[model samples]
Target chain A: MREEKPGPLWLRLYALTVYLFLYTPIVVLVLFSFNDSRRNSSWEGFTTRWYVTLWHNELLMRALLNSLKVACLATFLSTVLGTMAALALSRYPFRGREAVGALAYLPMMVPEIVMGIALLTFFIKVGIQLSIVTVILAHVAFSVGYVTVTVRTRLAGMKGNLEEAAADLGATPWQTFWLVTFPRILPGIMSGALLAFTLSFDDFVITFFTAGIGATTLPLKIYSMLKFGVTPEVNAISTIMLGFTIGLLALWSRLESDPKSLGR
Target chain B: MKRFLAWALVLPFVLYNLTFVIFPLFTVLYQSMFTIDAEYNVSQQASLDNFKAAFSAANLEVMWRSARYALTTTAACLLLGYPLAYFIAVYGGRLRSQLLILVVLPFWTSYLIRTFAWTTLLQKEGVINAVLLKLHLISQPLQMLNTDFSVILGLTYGFLPFATLPIYVSLENQDRSLVEAAADLGATPVQAFWKVVFPLSLPGVISASLITFVPAMGDFVSAEILGSPETQMIGNLIQQQFLALFNWPMGSALSLVLMLLMVTSMALYMGLAGERDA
Candidate 1:
C-alpha cells in the first residue's frame, strides 16, 4: 500500500471556510434572536424577551398554527397517495409506467414559480375559491412528489418475493400486505411522510399564489413582516420554526436508523 | 383482472394529478395562447401575442440575467462544496455519518429564513462589514447588500448543501481499488484524481448542477430580500406580474416561456448526460 502523504493545510482551511459559509448566517439569526436591542446589528445584552414577545404575537402564532394544520393534513394525504403511486410503479408491470412516473415527478422538477402560477390559473379557471384548503391542495401537489421518490427508492431495494412468501404461508393478499409488506416498508413510508411534512411546512411560493384573502401561511406572514424591516422578533420566530423543523428531523432520524432505509 | 386491480391502486393519485398538475399546466398553456381585453374577459381568439410579449427585449434580458446568476451560483457551490464533500467522503472514515448529518441538518431549516439571514450578514452594518471594519481591512464598510454580489452569495450559501450531498455520495461510493491501481502503475495522486476519481464522479456533479441550477434559476426570495430592482431575475418578474400588475395573461405567458426554457435546457442536459453514461 502506498503511504499517504499528509494533506496540504490550505484544503483543510478551505473546508473550514465552506462550513463557515454554510453555518454563519443561521448562527447569526439564532444569535440575534436573543439580542436585547430591538435592532439586531449590535448586541446590547442577551435576553429571551424576544421569545416572550413571540408568545404574545397573535398574528404570527395564528399563522404558525395554520401552517402546522396544513402541513399535517398535506403530509398525511401525500403519504397515502404517494405510497400507492410508489407501490403501483414497483409492484406492477403496467404499460405507460415510465410516463406515469414522469408525470408524478414533474412537480418536483419544475420551477417553483411555474408550479405556483400554473396552479393559481387552474384554481381561478375552475372557480375554486382560494383558502387554506387550496393551500393544502397545493402543498400536497408537490409533497406527493417527494414522498413517491423516497418510498419508491426503498421499494426498489426490497426483495420482491416477500409478498409471495406471505401468500405461500396461506395469508390472504390484504393480510399479506398488512403483516409482511407494511412492516418492511413502514420506515420508508415514515421518512417520506416526515419529508412531506417539512416541505409542506416550509412552502412559500405555492402557498403565496394559491392563498387568497385570509389564508396566510407562516412564510407569507414572514414576507410581510420583512417588507417593513428585519427585527429581533422575526429572528425569534424563525429560530422557533427552525427548532420545530429540527425536532421533526430528529423524529425522522430515529425512524430511519435502519440501514435498509435510504438514509436520504 | 389482477392487472386492473393493480392499476386501481393508482387511480386516486392519477385523479389528483389530473386536477392539480395536468389541469394547472394546461391553464398556463391556454392562458399564454390568448390575450385578455379591456373588460377582463377571456376571448376565444387564440394567438401567440402573449408569448411574443413574454419574450420581449426586457423580459428576455431578465431571463438572460437569471441564467447568468444561476450559472454563477452553480459554479460557486461546486467550487466550495466539492472539497468539503471530498473531505467528508474520503477522510471521514469512521465519522462519515456524523459528518454527513451535520451537513444535512442545516438543510432542514426554512430556506427563506436562511436567505433573510444573509441580509443581516451583508448589510452595511451587518456582520461581515462589522468584522471587516474591526480588522482595519478597509477604511469603509463595503456596499455588499442589495448587489449582485450579495444575491449570488446568498444563493451559493443556500444551495451549497444540495451540491455537497450528491458529490459526497459519488465520492464515497467510488472504487478505491481503481485509485490504488493507478498509484501502482506509478501515476501520481493528482493524475489518479484526474484520470479516475473525477471521471467517476461526473454523474454526481451533473446531478449537483441540476439541483443547484434549477432552484437558483427559479429563486426570487434571495433577489427580493437581498437585491435591488436592478438585480431582479425572471422569478421576481413573474411575482411582480402576478401580484403587482394583476396581469394574469402576461404572467401566464411569462410562466410558460420560463417553463419552456427550463424544460428545453433540462432535456438538453439529460441528453448530454445520457450520452456521458454511454
Candidate 2:
C-alpha cells in the first residue's frame, strides 16, 4: 500500500466547515436545553428547569411511553419476520423468490407519506381504529425491509460449511441452527432490531397519520410542541431523544462496523 | 420437506406485506378513482374527478414547486456533500470511521428535532440574527424564517448525509492505482480527477441524487416548520387534504401522482446513467 498523502489545505478547511455546519444545530439544541430562559433567541444562565418540567409534563411522558411501547413491539415483530424471510431467501431457491424480494423492498421504496396515507385509508376502510396498534403495524411493515437486508447480508457472508459441519456431527437440524447458525446471525438480528426501534421511535410522518387521539408518540408530541412554538422544554426533550438515538447507534456500530450496511 | 419449511418460514412476512404494503397501495389506487361528497362520504361511483383536481392549476403549482425544491436540494447536497465525501475517502486514513460516524450521527437523530433546531437559528430574533445584530452586521434582523431559503436549507441539511455516504462508498471502493496511472500518464491533477475519479463515482452520485431527491420531494416537515402556507409542498398538501380538509380521495390522488413522478424520474435518471456508462 502506498503512503497516504495529505489533502489540500483548502479541502481540509472545506471539510471542517461542513462538519461545523452538521454539528452546529445539534450543539445549539443541546446547549439551549439547559438555558434558563423560555426564549431560544439568546442564552441565559444555566438551569435544569426544562428537564424537570419535561419529566412532569404528562402528555409528553405519555407520548414517550407510547413511543417505547410501539418501538419495542414493532422491533420484535419485524426482526423475527425479517430474519425468517432472509433465511428462507438465502437457504432455498424457490420460484417467485425475486417477486417476494421486490415485495419486501416495496415499503422502503415508496415514500413515507404515500404509505402513511395508504395505511390510514386501509385501516379506516377495514374498520380498524387508528391507534398504537396501527402505528406498530406500519412500523413493522416499513422496518421489515431493513431487517431483511441486514440479515441477508450476514447470511451471504456466512460460510455454508459451518452449518453442514454441525449437522455432520450427529446434530439435528434444530440443534445445528441453535448452536451454529443462530449465533452467527445474532449480531445482524440485533442490529436490525436496533435500527427498527430507532426508526419507530423517531418516526413522525407515518405516526402522525396513523396515530389517533391519545396515541401520540414522542416525535408526534415534538411536532405538536414545535408547531406550538419554541420552548426550552422542547429542547430538553429533544436533547434526551437525541442522546437515546445516538446511544443506540453507537451500540449498532459496534455490532455492524461497516458503514456501507447503513446505506442499505 | 425443507422447501416446505422454507416456504412456511417466509409465509408470515409475505402475508404481512401483502396485507399491509401491497394491499394498501392498491387501495390508494382504487380510492383515487372515486369521489367524495360534501359530507365526507366516499361515493360508490368511480370517476376521474380526483385525478383532475390533483392536476388543477393550484395543485400543479405545488407539485411543480415540490419538484423544483427537490431538484435544488439535490443540487445543493451534491455540491456540498461531494467534496466532503471526497475529502474523507481520500485523506481520512485513520479517522475515516470516526468522520463517517459524525456525518451519520445527526442523521440518526430525529429529523423533527434537527429542523426545529434550525427554527431556533433562523427565527427573526433567533441565534443567527442575535449574533449578526450583536456584531452590527445589519441594522435589522432579516426575515430568515418562514421562507423558501429556510425550507430549502433545512432540506439540504437534513439530507446531506444521504448524499455523502453513497458518494464516499463509491470513492473508497475505487482502485487507487487508477488515479496513479492517470498521474503517470502525464495528466494534470484536475484532468485526472475529472476523467478518472469523478467518472468512477458516478454510481454513487446517482444513488445520492435519488435517495436525497425522493425524500426531499416527499418531505413536508421542513416546509411545514420552516415555510409558510405559501411555500407548502405536495407533502403538506396531501397532509392537509387527509388530516385537515378531510378529503381522502384527493389525498390519495395526490399521493399517486407523487409516486408516479418519483418512479418516472428514477427511470429517466437510471436510463441516462446507463447510457453514460455505455
Candidate 3:
C-alpha cells in the first residue's frame, strides 16, 4: 500500500462544507423542536412540550400505529419472499432464472409515481378497498427487490464449503441447512428485514395513492401537517423518527461490520 | 427433487411480482388508451386522444420543465457530489467508512422530513431569511420558497447521496499504480486526473447520473412541498390528474410517457457509456 498522505487543505474544507450543507437543515429542525415558542420564526426558551403534545395527539398516534403495522407486515412478507428468491437464484440453476431475476428487480427501477398510480388503477379495477392493507401490499411490492438484493449480496460473499462439510458429516439436507446455512444467512435476513421495514415506514408517494380515508401513515400525516403549516410538533415527531431510523442504521452497520458477533 | 425445491422457492416470488407489479403496469397501459369525460366517466371506445392530449402545448411545457429541472438537479448533484466522493475515496485513509456513514446518515432519514426541514429554513419568516435580515444582507426577506430554486435545491439535496455513493464506488475501485505511472511519465497531477482517474470513473458518473436523473424526473414531493403552481412538474401534473381531477386516463398517459422517457434516456446513456468503454 502507498504511504498515507493527508489531502489538500482546500479539499478537506470543501468536504466539510458539503457535510454542513447536508446537515444544517436537520440540525435546525432538531433545535427548533425544543423551542418554547409556537412560531418557528424565532427561537425561544427550550421545552419538550411539543413532544408531550405529540403523545396526546390522537391522530398522530394512530398514524404511528398504522405505520408500524404496515411496516411490520410488509417487512415480514417481503423478507420471506425475497430470501427465498435470493437463495434459489444463488444456489440453484434453473431455466428462466435470469428472466425471473430481472422481473424481481424491476420494481427498484420504476418510478414511485408510476407504481403508485398503476397500483391505484389496478386496485380499483379489481374492486379491492384502499386501506392499510393496500398500503402494506404496495409497500411489499416495492421493498421485496431491496430485500432480495441485500440478501443476495450477503449470499455472494459467503463460502459454500461450510454447508458441504455439514452434508459430508452425515447431516440430512434440512439439518445441514438449519445447522449451517441458516445460521450463516441469518445476518443477511435480519438486515434485509430491517431494510424492508425502513422502506415501508418511510414511503410516502405510493402510500399516498393507495391509502384511503382513515388509513394515514406517518409520512402522509407529516406531509399534511407540513401543508397545514409548520409547527414544533412536526419537528419533535421528525426528530424522534430521525433517532429511530439512525438507531436502526447503527444496528445494521454493526451487523454488517462484525457478522461473526452474531455468534455463528 | 432438487430442481423441484428450487422452483418451489422461486415460484411464490415470481407469482407475487406478476400479480402486483406486472399486472399493474399493464393496467396503466390499458387505461391510457381511453379518455375520461367531464363527469369522470371512462369512455367505452379507446382512442389516441389521451396520448394526444398528453402532448398538447400546456402538457408539453410541463414535460419540458420536468426534464429541465431534473437535468439541472442532476448537474448540480454531480458538481457537488463528485468532489466530496473524491475526497472521501482518495484522502480518507483511516476514516473512510465513518465519513461514508455520515454521508448516508442523512439519507437514511425520512425524505419528507428532510424536505420539510427546508421549509423551516427557506420560508420568508424562516431561519435563512432571519439570518440574512440580521446581517443586513437585504432590505426585506427574499422570495426564496415556492420557486424553481427551492425545488431544485431540494432535489439536489435529496439526491446528493445517490450521486456520491456511485461515484465513490467507481473512484475507490481504481488502481493506484496507474496514477503513479502517469506521474512517472512526467504527467502533472491535473493531467493524471483528467486522463487516468476521471476516465476510469466514468462508469460511476454514468450510473450516478442515471439514478439521479431518473428519480428527479418523476419526483413530485420536492416540487409539491417546495414549489408554486407555476413551478409544477410532470409529477405534480400526474398527481393532480389522478387525485384532484379524477382523470385517470390522462394520468396513465402521462405516466407511460414518463416511463418511455426514462427508458430512452437509460438506453441512450448506456449506449454512450458503452462506446466510451470500446
Contacts from the true interface found in each model, as a fraction, amount to 0.64, 0.79, 0.81
Off by over 4 Å in 2: A258-264
Candidate 3, superposed: residue stretches over 4 Å from native: B275-278
lDDT of 1 at B209: 88
What residue pairs are clashing in model 3?
none
Best candidate, TM-score = 3
DockQ of 1: 0.64
Kindly report, for each predicted structure in the order presented, the TM-score of its chain A compared with the true chain A. 0.94, 0.95, 0.96
Q: What tens-digit string does per-residue lDDT give for candidate 2 at A1-264?
A: 778777999999999999999999999989999998988878789999999898889999999999999999999999999999999888888878898888778888899999999999999999999888999999998999889988888888877798889888989989988888887788888888999999999999888889988889999998888867989999999999999999999889988985344332
Q: Per-residue CA lDDT of candidate 3, range A169-192, in tens?
A: 999989998888988999999999
DockQ score of the complex predicted as candidate 2: 0.79
Residue B226 Cα positional deviation in candidate 3, in Å, after optimal superposition: 0.4
Q: Of the true contacts between chains A and B, what fraction does model 1 have?
A: 0.64
lDDT of 1 by residue, B1-278 (tens): 65786688787788888889988988888887778777777668899888888888988889998889998999998998888898877777667788788788878788889899988888888888888999999889999989989889889878888889999999999988899899999999899999899989998999998889988988888899999998999899989988888778888888777777777777888899899789
| DockQ-based CAPRI category assigned to the predicted complex of candidate 1 | medium
Clashing pairs in 2: none
Cα distance off (Å), candidate 3, residue B53: 0.3
lDDT of 3 by residue, B106-162 (tens): 887898889889998999999999999999999899999999999999999999988
Per-prediction TM-score to the true structure, in the order listed = 0.95, 0.97, 0.98
User: Which of the two candidates, 1 or 2, achieves a greater lDDT against the reference?
Assistant: 2
